[model samples]
Each structure stands twice: as C-alpha cells, then as structure tokens.
Target: MKLHFLGTCAGTEPMLDRKHASVAVECDKKLYWFDAGEGCSYTGHNMGLDLLDVKNIIISHTHMDHIGGLGNLLWNIRKLTQMRSELPHFDGVDVFIPNEDSKDGLLKLLSHTEENFCCDYENRFYGVQDGVLLDDGKVKVTAYHNTHLVRWETDKPLSYSYRIEAEGKSVVYSGDVGLYTDLDPVIGDGCDALLIETGHFGIDIAYDYIKDKNVKRVFFTHNGREIINDREGSLAKVARLFEGRGTICEDTLTVEL
Candidate 1:
C-alpha cells in the first residue's frame, strides 16, 4: 500500500508550500481519502493520481481545514468524468462524514454550480459513527470517537480518529485531538504507522505520548507553529527523538509500506 500526503499544514493562517490536512491511502488501484483539505484534489491530480479511482472519502471532523476542499474535490471528479467520457471506477462513491448538516450544506452550495453539480456517478453520503466504517475485502477501516470537538447531541460523535488495516498492516490517522490520550481507544494494541496531527500540540508532547506505544512509524501532519517556523530544526529534533522512525510530512510526499 502507498500513503500519499496531499496537504500537511495545520488549521492556522496560510503558509507557503502547504495547505491543510489531507492524505490518501492507495491499495489495489483504489484510493481511500482521509480528509479533503484545501487543494487536496488539485494536488493529488497534479501529483499524477487518478481522482476517479477514489472510492471512499472519510472525514474525521467537519472543521474547515479538514473539509475545505470537499466540494471542489467532488466537482473535479465530476469534471474529469465528463471530460474523459468515462464512468468513475465505482458506480458510486461513499463519503463518510461525522456531520450530516455540514454535508448537506456543501451539497446545497454545489447545486448552484454548472450542470447543477450533476454527474453520471452517484456520490453517496454516510453519517460516520463509531466502530467499523468500511470493510471492502482489500482494506478495513474503523472509526473511534475523539474529543477534538465536543458533542452537544447524544446520537453520534462529532469527531473521530481512524484505524485502517490493510495487507496485514494497521495504520492510524489522528485527525485532530483534544489530547493525545484521546486516541487510546483506536490505538488499541498498536499500529504500524501513525499519521498524527501536530496542530494542537508540540513535537515533544507527541513524542512523549507515543514513546511507550507500539507504533512503528510516526508521520506528523497538520503542523503547528513550531514545525512551520523552523522546519529543519524541528526535523532535526524529531530525528534525534525518534531515531528515524518519525517523519515531518510535507505536501506530495508518498511513502510505501
């Protein structure tokens, strides 16, 4: 499986050479999108990725940085299908979002675009809840609620972290968390790779939290001020702390596992 980093910046003021948070896991020629941050689709396409191959899009939360590019991503897919005169890889795409209201709002806004935002393929939306979100034989994805956002309603969780298991490897995507411990439930035994966010915490905090865990690799995304201001210094520090097991991810970086 290949992990693609589309956007790696945090939800802070805009920065050069980065957007927000977005990643794609490619397995068996199919793409599983984690978050649709700004310029996600554009970056993926420009990186030579096939947007039509995206079968599922899972959002950890409805934060602007996480879902900023959602509408544009969908539009780009539809535009590609039209231009190529070919159907999408799947009959429909499954979009798992924690907030249905946000999804509705995005769809409503898209309805005003060209062709009424209509396409040949269906873009099905699903409300994300705890437990297994997808099991497509090739990959299994499970969701665990996090406290990044408070839940005013009792029906479902408002924020989440994901555990993706594919080809005997388990990976965790910590969207944004109120605390590092918020991921204990999903971390479970351990994960092969942890794609964590550093937007809310510092690198020292992250390292201290996962040092005892069984995670094999750590890729830091959603960078905060510390890493943004002094990337080289932060990377040097991470290299010393993690002994090469950690990475300060940048946009368009692809890693195979």
Candidate 2:
C-alpha cells in the first residue's frame, strides 16, 4: 500500500508548501481519504490520483482545517464522472464523519449548489464510531476516539485516530490528538508507520511520548508552530532526536508502505 500526504499544515495562516490535514491510503487501487483539508482532492487529483477511485472519506473532527475541502471533493468527483463518458468504476463513495451533523451540514451545503447538487454516483455518509469502521477487501480500518474535539461525550466517542491494516502491515494515524497518550489504545503494540501530528506537540514531546513504544517509522503531519516557523531548524532537531525514525512530511508527498 501507499500513503499520500495531500495537506500537512495546521489551522494557521497559509504557508509556502502546506495546506491543512489530509492523507490517503492506496489499497487495491482504491483510495481511502483521511481528513479533507483545504484543496486536498485538488492537490491529489492534480498529482495524477483519480478522485473517482476514492472509496472512503474519513473525518476525525468537524474543524474547518480538517474538512475545509470536503464539499469540493464531492463536487470534483461528480464533475469527473460527468466529464467522462463512463460512470465511476466503484459502486459508490462512503464518507465517515465524526458526527452526523458534519455530514448533514455538508450535504445541505452541497444541495444548495448547482442542479441541487445532483450527481451520477451514489455517495453515502456514515457517522464515525470507536470500532472497526471499514473492512475493505485489502485493508481494515479501526477507529479509536482521541481528544481532538472539545465537544466529545464520555458515553459516545465522536473523534478518532485510525489504525489501518493492509498486507500484513499496519499504520496508525493520529488525527490531531489532544495529547500523544490519547493514542495509547490505537497505537497498541506497534505499527509499521505512525502518521503523527506535530501541530500541538513539539519534536521532543513526540519523542518522549513514543520512546517506549514500538513504532518503526514516524511521519509528522498537520504541522504547527515549530515546523512552520523554522522548517530547517525543526527538521534538524527532529533528525538529531529520532535519527532515522522520523520524517517531516510535505504536501503531495507519497510514501510506499
């Protein structure tokens, strides 16, 4: 499988080469989108990715930085199908959002657009929960609530971090956690790759949090003050700390896992 970083910026003003937060896992020619940050689909599609190939869109929270491009993503997919003579190869597109309101709000907004947002493909939405959310033939996605959202209820977890398992390999995505320890359950024993966020925590904090864990590779995304303020300095500091275990992710960067 391959992981594509569409946007790596956080909820800050525009940067040079970063957007917001989004990633896509490619398995069996199907794309599983995680977080639809601003211009995510645009960046991915322009990079030669087929928007129609997207099977699932997962959201960690309802923040604009995370879902800024969601409506555009759906619009672009429908536009692609209309432009082409053929329908989408996949049956439908499924979106998993942290709350029902997020999906409903997006649908309402889209419905107000052209042609009442009519489309040629079936797009389904699901509310995210803490459990196995998707079991595609090639990969299984498990969601565990994190402390990213302030409106989370103790009885019902709406925010999440994801553990993606495919081809005997696993990767954990920390979707803007409130704290690194919030990923303990999702992290579990270990993972081949950990797509962690550095928006809220520093390099040293991240190192300390995962020091005793069994993470093979760490790719930092959803960048924050440290990286945005001083890219070279942050990279150098992270390199000195994790040596070969860490990588500062960039927008539109693709990695094979």
Candidate 3:
C-alpha cells in the first residue's frame, strides 16, 4: 500500500512548505482519499496520481482546514472528465462526511459551479457514524468517534478517527482527535502504521502514548508550531527518541508500506 501526503499543515495560518490536512491511500490499484484540505487535488495531480481512480472520499470532520478544498476537488474531477476520453474507473465516488449541514452546503456550493455541477458520473454523500464504515474487497475501514467539539448528548458526533486494514496491514489515522485515547477503540492492540495528527498535541505526547504500544511506524501530520520552528532539532529528537521509527511527513511525499 502507498500513502500520499498531500498536505501536512494544521488549521493554522498560512505556512511555508505546507498546505493543510489531507492524504491518499493507494491500494488494489485504487485510491482512497482522506480529507479534502486546501490544494489537495492540485498537489495530487502534480504528483502524477490519476485523480479519476479515487473511489472514496472520507472526511474526518467538517473543519475548514479539512474540507476547504472539497468543492474545488469535485470541480477538478468534473473538469478532468471532459479532458480525458474515458470516465473514472468507479464511474462515480462515495463521499463519507460527518456533518449533514456541511455536506448540504457543499452540494449547494457545487450547484453554483459551471453546468450546475453536471457530470456523467454519480456522486453520493453519506453521514458518518461509528462502526464499520466501508469494507471494499481490498480495504476495511472502521470509524471511532471522538469528543473534539463540545456538544449536547443528543447531538451526533463531529469528529472521528479511522482504522484502515488492507492486505494484512493496519493503519490508524488520527483525525484531529480530541485526545489520543479517543483512538483506543479503533486502534485496539496495535496498528502497522499510526498516522497521528499533532495539530492539537505535541510529539512528546505522541511518544509517551506510542512508546509502549505496538506501533511500527509513526508519521506526524497536522503539525504544530513547535516542530515547524525547530525542524532540525525535532528530526534529531525523533531519531533518538523513536529510534528512527518516527517521521515528520511532508506534503507531496508518498510513502509505501
């Protein structure tokens, strides 16, 4: 499996060498996109990835940094369909989102685009709930809710983490988690790779959490200022502390496992 890191910045102001939070998992010759952060489509296409091969669009939550470029992504997909002689492999895409208002708002936004967002393929959006989300032939994804935003007990959750299993390998994506323990349910005993977000936490916190856990590789995404301000020091620290198991991922870099 391959993981393409399109954007690695958090929900902070503009920064150099970073965009936002987004990544794509390539498995079974298909692409599964997670988060449509700003400029994701631009970066992905430039990286030589066929956007048409994307079969699933999974959003952790509706935060701006996470969904800012969603409309543009759809528009690009439609635009590319006209340029290419053939259509997307899936003929359409399934979008798994958590907030109904956000989904509705995006659809409404798309309607204002050219041709009223018309296309030859179908695009479906579904609300995300805690459970086995998708089990395509090559991958199984499970969602675990987290308390990122304060809400009433009756309100549906607004945040989640994901566990993706493919070809006997497991990956835990920490989607702007409220706390590290928020991923316990999805992570279980261990995961082959932990794509943990550090937008709301630090590397030390991650180190403490995974030091004893069975995480083979750790890639830090949605990074905070500490790492950005001291990348050289952070790299050395991670090398020594994680024993070369941790990496500060960068946008446009694809890692295969």
Error of 2 at 147 (Å): 1.7
Error of 3 at 7 (Å): 0.5
Identify the candidate with maximal lDDT: 1
Worst 10 residues of 1 by lDDT: 83-92
Model 2 lDDT, residue 251, Cα: 95
Q: Per-model C-alpha lDDT, please?
A: 0.93, 0.90, 0.88
Model 1 has an lDDT value of 0.93
Cα TM-score of candidate 3: 0.97
TM-score of every model versus the real structure: 0.97, 0.96, 0.97
- What is the Cα-based lDDT of residue 150 in candidate 3? 38
Full candidate order by lDDT, most accurate first? 1, 2, 3
Error of 1 at 220 (Å): 0.3
The sequence of per-residue lDDT tens digits that candidate 3 reaches over residues 32-123 is 99998999999999999988888899999999899997888888888888888664444789999888778888888899988898888898
Candidate 2 lDDT over residue span 126-233, tens digit each:
888889999966889999988777563555665789999998999999998978999999989999999999999988899999888999999999999999889999
Model 3 CA RMSD to the hidden true structure, in angstroms:
1.3
